[model samples]
Target: MNWFMEFLATGFYSGKLPKMPGTWGSIFAAVLAYFLWPSNPDFQVLVILITFFLSVVSSDYLARKLGDKDPDQVVIDEVLGVEITFFLLNPQGDLELTLAGLILFRIIDIMKPFPIRLFERLPGGWGITVDDAVAGVLANILLRVIGGFL
Candidate 1:
């Protein structure tokens, strides 16, 4: 079952699991966030912040061990990024906001704007994960601003 563990850890089977692994991972993370988010807004914000930070650090290492430059199979970064976006919006479990946040995270991640492209140049798994994290941060700020106005 060693192979199975590697497959699961690397998310290699993610492609056959239904939706794109990146998207599916994000959805799964969001569900987790929904359950973990505290009733107190301050605590929820703290949880999001900590989750984003840990996701970046851990995914970086995991990507390197799994090999491949930004492997499609490694999607925890996407999960964390989408979680960061939705958390910033403070959606109160609104499905519309969740969908929008997912779209926004995916778009920004694909676009790789500005410093995000620069971050990708860093060596190893840091290169793999940092760019996406930056994209997530940017998307989070934009969503927060938009949420403020609405």
Candidate 2:
């Protein structure tokens, strides 16, 4: 159980990287989304929502063991963020669009502008998951708007 939590918290070990674990986790999420993305919008929404809920549980439990509000190595939040960002845009297998979404989501997550930062303090895994979820929502809107122009 402990190792399983660590595995999940580490975003399948992408978070174990020496630097920028969140970024690595996001990258992993992007690759996963590219390969396994669903064609149906309903399914995409379902998958991301489930991932978010599971991440919240595992992340909160692991955060408790680590004695940190949000440990750097706990990056399932990154996975949730990336999944949410890609859910509505239909980026799927499009390399350029997926890359753009990844970049945008990471920037917003890293910067945590406006309410993004506020969501980080929501308590337990809710805090850990939502900040990045907000970033994902922002990235999704931007990606949709920009993808329309290009």
Candidate 3:
């Protein structure tokens, strides 16, 4: 149903929140991941893959419904991005790491540098999702590097 798709695409209605819905959705994802995601790397990958798929499907549907290339209400992309940000690193549900990943992911997503921005030019769901996905990966890599140094 449309309501169900909308709920998913809107990141469980966090996107409907006034101001910076993407940030809200990212936070939601981070919090949810913190509580629900397990410590297994394989499980993390599986979760990410499943989230990515749902993001694409829901985003595409939302775009079509809203008649926008990337509606602000579709924050599932942000959710997926944040999930990818933590990836294998936040499986322990460490609040500090989760917070760091959330901040880094939001910054990278907002900045949209280099190839990250380029992904937005893709059609439909991919156009809406890949850019954030790249941002998430970049943030995760940055976290890994920072962890390595510390």
Candidate 4:
């Protein structure tokens, strides 16, 4: 159906998805990260980085197609960013790391520290996606630091 394709194309109705598309997308992304990232730190880190990059480039186009400014349903950016955040912890599919990464990503995402806010101001999809990438980076750093101590 036309609606179904549109939904998938816009990231499962996230573009017009209710509430905060970015936040919802990130939640979905976090869940995905839990399943996709390998137990091996190196592999997980690589995947995270790659995914982040791809999301950054793609989210804009997705947003445009959906006919909205950073539609809530086009949540791939958030999902990718959250995945990057959790990948920093290299959780081996553990719930604790997933939870921690989720909290950290959400906090930093909401706060939009410094350049993160700047990134959001960028034009088009890049603007839409970069902010979340920055949040992911910050969260990743914090998570890595905590990981070192644990």
What overall lDDT goes with each candidate model? 0.64, 0.89, 0.89, 0.71
Model 2 regions lying over 4 Å from their true place: none
Q: Give per-model CA RMSD.
A: 3.7, 1.0, 1.1, 3.3
List pairs with backbone clashes in candidate 4: 14-72, 14-73, 14-74, 15-72, 15-73, 15-74, 21-72, 60-125
What tens digits encode model 1's per-residue C-alpha lDDT throughout 1-150? 545433443434442355476766666655655555455667757765665555555555656666666666666666657666765355557666666676778888878889789987887656756776787788888877776788
> Candidate 4: minimum summed lDDT over ten consecutive residues — where?
2-11
Q: Poorest 10 consecutive residues of model 3 by lDDT?
A: 84-93
Tens digits of per-residue lDDT for model 2 on 53-146? 8889989998999899999999999999998888766666789988998999998998888989999879999999989888989999888898
Candidate 3 residue-wise lDDT, 1-150, digit = tens: 989989999999999999999998998898898898777889888988988888899999999988999999899999989888888775456888888888899999999989899999999999898999999999999989987887
TM-score of each: 0.71, 0.96, 0.96, 0.76
Q: How much lDDT does candidate 3 score?
A: 0.89
Predicted candidate 4 versus true structure: per-residue lDDT over 42-84, tens digit per residue? 8876776676565555665666666766666666677767767
Candidate 2 vs candidate 4, TM-score winner: 2
lDDT-based ranking: 2, 3, 4, 1
Ranking by TM-score: 2, 3, 4, 1
How far residue 120's Cα lies from its native spot in candidate 2, in Å, is 0.9
Evaluate model 2: give its lDDT.
Answer: 0.89
